[model samples]
Target: MTAINFAVIGYGGMGSYHIHNIMPNENERIHVVGTYDISGERQKISSQHKHKIYHSLEEVLTDETIEAVLIATPNDSHKDLAIQALKVGKHVVCEKPVTMNVEELDEVLKVAKETGQTFMVHQNRRWDPDFLITRELYKKQQIGELFQIESRVQGANGIPGDWRHELKHGGGMLLDWGVHLLDQLLFLVDSRIEKVSADLSYILGDEVDNGFITYIIFENGIRAIIEVGTTNYTKLPRWYLKGTQGTAVIQDWDLSGEMIVDSGKKNIQAPKPIQAGVGLTKTMAPPSEEATETVALPKITAEYDTFYKNFYKVVREQAEPVVKNEEVRQVMVLIEEIFKAAKR
Candidate 1:
């Protein structure tokens, strides 16, 4: 199989990461031909790394040899860059949030359809090990029927970079981290959202939120809470899944956590009342040792690095994209709804 050649449109943090870390080798299915960045400093850096540096977007677009381009620019620039790449007969791999809003994304999607080029969003969080384990438990019922899921990421650092602090640039935890969390939830649930509510944090006083919490109710009776925090010094579990028969917690990116399930032992010992703050309460007591059994978190076999591999397949062999445009749009639509709900 031939490798699909790609160019980096914006050689910033994420763009640089892609060119260096993601583009594996000559043997891989994807190759980085060069980069296009308005910043001369970034262009110099790209050249230092032995990549062909294009001076302008036009220069990159007109290069008939480059089959695809990755848009790692600011969130607001995603729509125009994606549309231009598609119109020029190049497939596109865009960063998360895809665009500032659903309307902007819709316009890009229209161009992609007209040009018949693959347009896939980099919703890479779907491949996260923590999420993969939870998804496996959801599908296999390793514990039981999972009914509640809490997914979150927290940091003591405020907004990480300059543009991320400004609303015009699509800065904020909602558009930044929120997009990934929501995408993972949507991908895992596989059900229509029956209801939505949200609260965005502005404690840092930026025009955009520093954090946010969104509660989503699914048609299949599953409840999901997605949250992102910039002020949290101590953090909650990265993922918490509750099933009728067991519970699992993925504490951090390291995938630390545990699972406890129904013991299913006949005539298990009953729980005894425990001391409360001021009084004794049986309802708040812990489950008796005989009632539940602790187990290791389920192991998953999916790899997270397959994003570019799938992109190559979609662009070269007309394979269906793992990250579909419609799914990307749906996440954007849900983001819009979250904004409206927060306004209320």
Candidate 2:
């Protein structure tokens, strides 16, 4: 297979991380030919990593050898870079929140169709282990029929850096972390959202929201709560899912969690009422030890295809993209609705 040459724009946090996380080996069918960053300092960093740095976007785009462009710049720049790359007939792999707004994404899509290039968003969270575990549970029905799912990510550091705090740059937790959580929920449920309600917090007083909570109701009778926060000192469980016959909790990124399911056989003895501050109540009591079975989370099968591999396959017309453009457009539309609901 001929190795596809690629260029990366933006050499900041995510851009540099992509170098290490997604770049294929030298023998693979793809390679990062070079990188472009506005900051000389960031360019220097990329040089230190042994990558050639292009002086400008035109340099990268004009290169006939480059088959693809990875746009890892700020959210606001995603649409422009992707459109330019697509216009030049290069396949594009753009970062999430694909564009600041749905309208911008539509423009990018138009260029992609005109150019006949493969365009896909880097919604990498679809392959995240925790989400994969949750999806596995949902598919396997390990805890019976899933009815409620809550996904959250919180930090006390407040909004990070300048671009995220400025509205013009598309700064906000919703577009940041909220996109991943919502995408995961939609990927797992396979249902059209019946309705959505949201509340975005500006407690930190930035131009953009510091946090948000979005409630989504699905056509399959599943309800999901997706949240992202920057001021949360005491965080909630990373994931809490409840089903008709059991419950699952994942505490953090370490994948620490368990599943407890009803054992079908009833407990031989009734549970004693536990004392509360004001009264004793059987309803609030914990289930007897014998009533439920505790089980380790099932091992999740990993689909280890790199973003480039899928892009190559899509370009070859051999397979459909795992990160489909239509799915990405839906997420962008959902994000717009989330922002609107929060404003209301």
Candidate 3:
């Protein structure tokens, strides 16, 4: 199969990541022919990296060799840039928080339909190993029917970089990290969200949220608590889940965690209660060791390359995208709801 030529717009962190790390390992299904960024400094960096740098976006758009454009620009510019690329008959691979809101995404989706171009967002966390392992457990019910899911990502760094601190660029933890965690939850649950409530933190005194916590109730009776923090020096488990039989926790990005399931063999003595500051209680005691078995996390094969591979398939073979526009739109809807709930 001929490699699909792709031009990366916005030669910043994520753009360079795709160019240096992702594209080099794509098995030749896609090629980055050139790149364009509004900042001359970024263009200079791209050139120094041996990539052809387009002086203007128009030049990249007019290039017949470029079949697609990857938009790693700010969230606010996604809709306009995506629409323009699609209009020029180029397939689009956009970064997360597809647009500022559902309405904006709808406009781009409409143009995609009219132009007969394939569009996909880079909700790449869907490929994260920790998430994949968790998803596997959810599907296999390894811990029994999951009733609660707790997902979080916390960093003590506060919000880094310049543009992310500005409201005009769709800057905030919600639009930034919130989308990834929320999207992963929505993907894992596979049920309609019945209700939602959220609180956005402004601890850093920015116009946008520095962090947020959202509670979601799924139609299937599953409850999800998704949170993102930029000020947490002491972080919580990356993934925690509760189910009928037992529980599972993925402690961090290292995929270090345990799944403890009821052994169901019986005849085990109860956990001995320990004296507390005020009193002793058996209710808060840990389960007897014989009553439950701690198991290692399910092994998950890495599939990061599938995102671009799926995009190529969609562009050339008319296959459905891995990260569909409809799914991304649902995440946008949820983001809006989170904002409203936070305000309240």
Candidate 4:
């Protein structure tokens, strides 16, 4: 099989990562032929690495040999870049928050349909090990009928990049990290969202939010609280889930956490009340050791290599894409709802 030739449209952090890290030679299915960046400095860096650097987007688009374009440009540029690539008969792999808004995404989708070119969004968080393990437990009912999930990422560092702090470029934690957590929740719940409430934080005095907290209620009775924080000196668990029989906590990216569940044994002894600050209470006592069991988190065995491989099949064999445009559009719609909820 012939390898599909791809060109990177923006040589920023993620763009470079895709070109260098993800474009594996062993795959023998995809190859990075060249790249384009508006920044001359970034182009120089790419040239230093021996990558063919296209002088402009037009150059990459007009190159007939480049069958696909991986767009990692600013959020505001995604729609135009994607549409241009599709118009020129090039398939497109757009970065997350595929567009600034759903309307923008709709326009790109329409053009993609007209051109009959494959268009896929890079919702890469679906492949994260923490998310994957949580998904597996949710599916298996590891804690028995999961009803609530809390997912978050916190840091003391302020917004890292320049463009990320500006509103015009679609900079904000909601559009940035929130998109990933919300997308992961949507991917796992398997139900439509019935309601949403959100609060966007602007503590840094920037026009855009530094972070946010969103509450989503799924039609299947699952409640998800997703948050992104940049001012946290101390952090909370990366994930906390509650179900009928037990609770699970994933402390951080290292996946350090545990699950404690009620033992199935019958006639378990009730907990004896311990000394309290002032008053004695049997209602707030920890369960007896015999009544519950604590265990290490389940091993994570999820694979993340399928994103590019599936894209290869979609482009080469006309197979269904793993990251479908329709799914991406749904996330955009949800993002709009989140914005509105935050406004309220």
What's model 2's lDDT at 201? 94
Range of the 10 consecutive residues with the lowest summed lDDT in candidate 3? 19-28
**Regions of candidate 4 where Cα sits further than 4 Å from its true position:** none
Q: 1-344, model 2: which lDDT tens digit per residue?
A: 67778888998999888778776654576788899999999999899989988999999999998998889999999988998889888988899889998899999999988888988898988888888899999999999999999999999999998799989999999999988887888788888999999999999888899999999999989999998989989989999999998999999988999999987885356778999888998888887888889999878866545666777778776588888888888888899999889788
Q: Which scores higher on lDDT, 3 or 4?
A: 3
TM-score, one value per model:
0.98, 0.97, 0.98, 0.97
State which candidate, 2 or 3, has the greater lDDT.
3
Candidate 2 residue-wise lDDT at 184: 83
In model 4, where is the ten-residue run with the lowest total lDDT? 296-305
Q: Write the per-residue lDDT of candidate 3 for residues 187-264, one digit (tens) a residue.
A: 888899899999999999998899999999999999999999999999999999999988999999999999999999
Q: Which lDDT values do the candidates have, in the order given?
A: 0.90, 0.88, 0.92, 0.90
* Per-residue lDDT over 1-344 for candidate 4, one digit per residue giving the tens place of the 0 to 100 score: 79889999999999998877776557788888888999999999999988898997889988999999999999999999999999999999999989999899999999999999999999999988888879878888888999999999999898889999998999998899988987888788889889999999999988999999999999989999999999999999999999898999999989889889989889988889887888887889888898889977778775656778888899889998888788888888998898899999
Evaluated against the true structure, the overall lDDT of model 3 is 0.92
Ranking by lDDT: 3, 1, 4, 2
Task: Give the worst 10-residue stretch by lDDT in candidate 1.
Answer: 19-28
- Candidate 4: global Cα-lDDT? 0.90
Which residue segments of model 1 deviate by more than 4 Å?
none
Q: Which whole-number lDDT from 0 to 100 does residue 51 have in model 2?
A: 91
Residue pairs with clashing backbones, model 4:
none
